[model samples]
Target: MLKRYKKYSFLFQELVHRDFTKKYKRTALGIGWSVLSPLLQLLVMKIMLTKFFATGIEHYTTFLFAGNIVFNYYNESTSSGMTALAENSAIISKVNVPKYMFVFSKNISSLISFLLTVVVFFVLAALDGIEFTWKITMLIFPIVCLVLFNIGLGLVLSACYTFFRDLQYLYSIFTFLLMYMSAVFYDISAYSDFAQKLFLLNPIYLFIRYFRKIVMEQTIPTIWFHLLMILDVCIVMIGGFYMYKKYNHDFLYYF
Candidate 1:
């Protein structure tokens, strides 16, 4: 498995480049559009929410940036991952490469886009006068954990999608709900105790909230937060790998 992962690792970078290039090849603006989408969303949300959210939390724009960056990548990967195997049917059938490669490639593509947007967010945060600290260095750990979590998620979801076409529809609806539940636009503390506990149980929420604490508040999350995230990553990656190993051969038949 390690050899297989390394063998096609080069393809990961190439696939990511292909996806990024094709997205803006003919456009006058080119890659600027990738920077534009998230920036525009941030502007619209800032305007629209000012009237309602009003006073703002401590470093609220930074808070939203943290949540938006991570959540957007998760949304893109899992949603596209639903068809990761099925969409690559012709290549998978003709080649002997690992089935997980197709799914992993889609995620690497999204990760490239996400990194581009992160630059925009960093610049905007500086312009908005949000403070940057050495604490910003802490972002590295959470990001690595988030990537591992997403890879596991994409692998498992891609596998299930092979067996259940309905998973495509289900994944769409779930992403919509997951976005709101992630507390992207509001503080989780606004919810009742039971609701907050439920949110804490959600590993995605944990990841987003941890980022928010580091970037927005310039502080680490509580000890339990790190503990929970570590546990969640372990379970998801292990379970996802097992499922992928067991049924990956079936993916070709579905495609």
Candidate 2:
């Protein structure tokens, strides 16, 4: 797969560049929106929810930042990637390039935005009096997992969207529900033990919890948590690759 990708490395780079540029084109703030948008969201959530949900929570702003950043990345990556094939139908129908490259390029563009937002997250954490600790470096683990997970998920969504246009509408509603379930602003501990455990079933919640553990609590997550993250990525990637392999040719017909 690496060799196949490398064979068209230039094309991949161009796709990534084009997508990134197109995202910010004619925008006043341009890339600054990546940093400002999440911070603005954090401020709004903090103001509205602090009295109700943030009780007993230390560094609540930082905690919300951790969750929001991760969730937003997944949401943006998957949403954009879902349209990769259909959006690029003109090019795909003409060129002999790998279809997955378009999906990957969309993901890469989202990732660049996510990374820009991380800088704001850390700065906010520092301002909130959260000390910088060695454990903070451990954020990379969950981030790497989320990136792979998003790529895998993007592939699946793009493939599915090619066939069933209704998925686009359904997924928007699902993402909204997912945002609330992810506990981005609320404290999951407010729920009963059984309910808390149930939230773990959400991969987005798991990734957010993992980030909070390292960023907010300054501790490493359990080995089982790490394993589960890897397992989730593998399951999605396997399923996504299978779909792409089976339906790559079929995508053109639908397009």
Candidate 3:
């Protein structure tokens, strides 16, 4: 994979630049939306749900920001990635380039937005009185995990999307359900032990939990937790790569 990217590094750079810049092409704030959009969401969620979910919860705004930012990045990357092939069908059909390149480029763009929001997240955390400690650096684990996971899922979604356009709409609904289940604006600590275990089954929720543990609880999760996170990435990565290999040729026909 590194070799492929190296061979096509020029195209990769162009794709990354185009993907990132095209998003805010005509907007006044341009790249500022990357931070403002998520911050606005955090304000609305905090104002609307604070009475119900924020009660007795410390640093509620930061907690909500953590979940919101993670899920937004997941949704944005995968959703844009799903159409990476179809949207660039003209270039994809004629240009001798990699299909995964589109996926990687789209995701890298969304990741740029996510990182911008994370800068604001830290500021909000400080204002909310959350103490920063050495463990906070550990969030690099889940951020990296989600990046790989999004790419893997992007590969699978883009492959499917070439054949079935309806997948785009269906995936939006799936992400909506995923957002609610991710406990973005609510507290899942109120659930039973068994129920809490069930939340771990959700890959999106797992990352959110990791954020809360590090930023809110000021502790690192166990090694088993790390293993489980990697397990989720592995399952998706293996499955996505398998589909791409199997459908590599078929993708051309769909175009």
Candidate 4:
């Protein structure tokens, strides 16, 4: 796979550039929207849910921002990846490029936006009086895990979407439900102990919780927690790659 990627590295770069440019094209604020959009979301949640959901939480806005950045990245990457093949059908049909490259490019674009939002999140955290600690450097672990997980997930979703047009709509509804369940604005402690354990089953929530631990709590997550994240990424990648390998040929027909 590395050899294949290296041989087509130029094509990958082109696709990444095109996708990134297209995402912000014709927008007045352009890339500024990446930072501004999440901040605006934080503002709305802060105003509406603060009194109700943020009780006993210190630096609630920063907490919410941490969750939002991680979840938003996953949402954007998977959603864009779901349509990667269909959207690029014409090019794929004519060119010899790798099918997964299209999905990867979309993820790269989303990742760029995600990184921008994360920088803003840190700034917001400082503004909220959350002190930076060396422990914050540990966030790279979860960030790397989430990125790999998103890539694997994108591959699987793009493959499935090629065969099933209805998946897009269903996925939209699923993400809506996922957002509420992720505790993006609320404290998970408000829930019963069983419910808190159940929320841990959610990979998105797991990543969010990891980020909050490092940023808001100023603590490193346990080694067991790190192993759980690694396990989640491995499961998703193995399954996704298996699907892609098995169905790569079929994608041309669906497209």
Local distance difference test values of all predictions, in order: 0.79, 0.92, 0.92, 0.90
* Runs off by more than 4 Å, candidate 2: none
Displacement of the residue 120 alpha carbon in candidate 4, Å? 0.7
Query: Candidate 1 at 46: error in angstroms?
Result: 2.0
Tens-digit lDDT track of model 4 for 183-233: 888888877899898987899999999999998888888888888899999
Output the better candidate (1/2) by lDDT.
2
Ranked candidates (lDDT, high to low): 3, 2, 4, 1
User: What tens-digit string does per-residue lDDT give for candidate 3 at 111-144?
Assistant: 9999989989999999999889999899999999
lDDT of 1 by residue, 147-187 (tens): 77888888888888888889888888988898888887778
- Tell me how far the alpha carbon of residue 26 in candidate 4 is from the true structure, in angstroms, after superposition: 0.9
**lDDT at 36 for candidate 3?**
89
How well does candidate 3 match the true structure in TM-score terms?
0.98
Score candidate 3 by lDDT: 0.92
| Tens digit of per-residue lDDT, candidate 2, span 1-255 | 899999999999999999999988999998888888888988898899899988889998988888899999999999999999999999999999999999999999999999999888888888999887898888898889999999999999999999999999999999999999999987877789999989988999999999888878888989988898899999999999999999988988998
Instruction: Quote model 2's TM-score.
Output: 0.98
Task: Give the clash count for each candidate.
Answer: 0, 0, 0, 0
Residue-level error in angstroms, candidate 4, position 117: 0.8
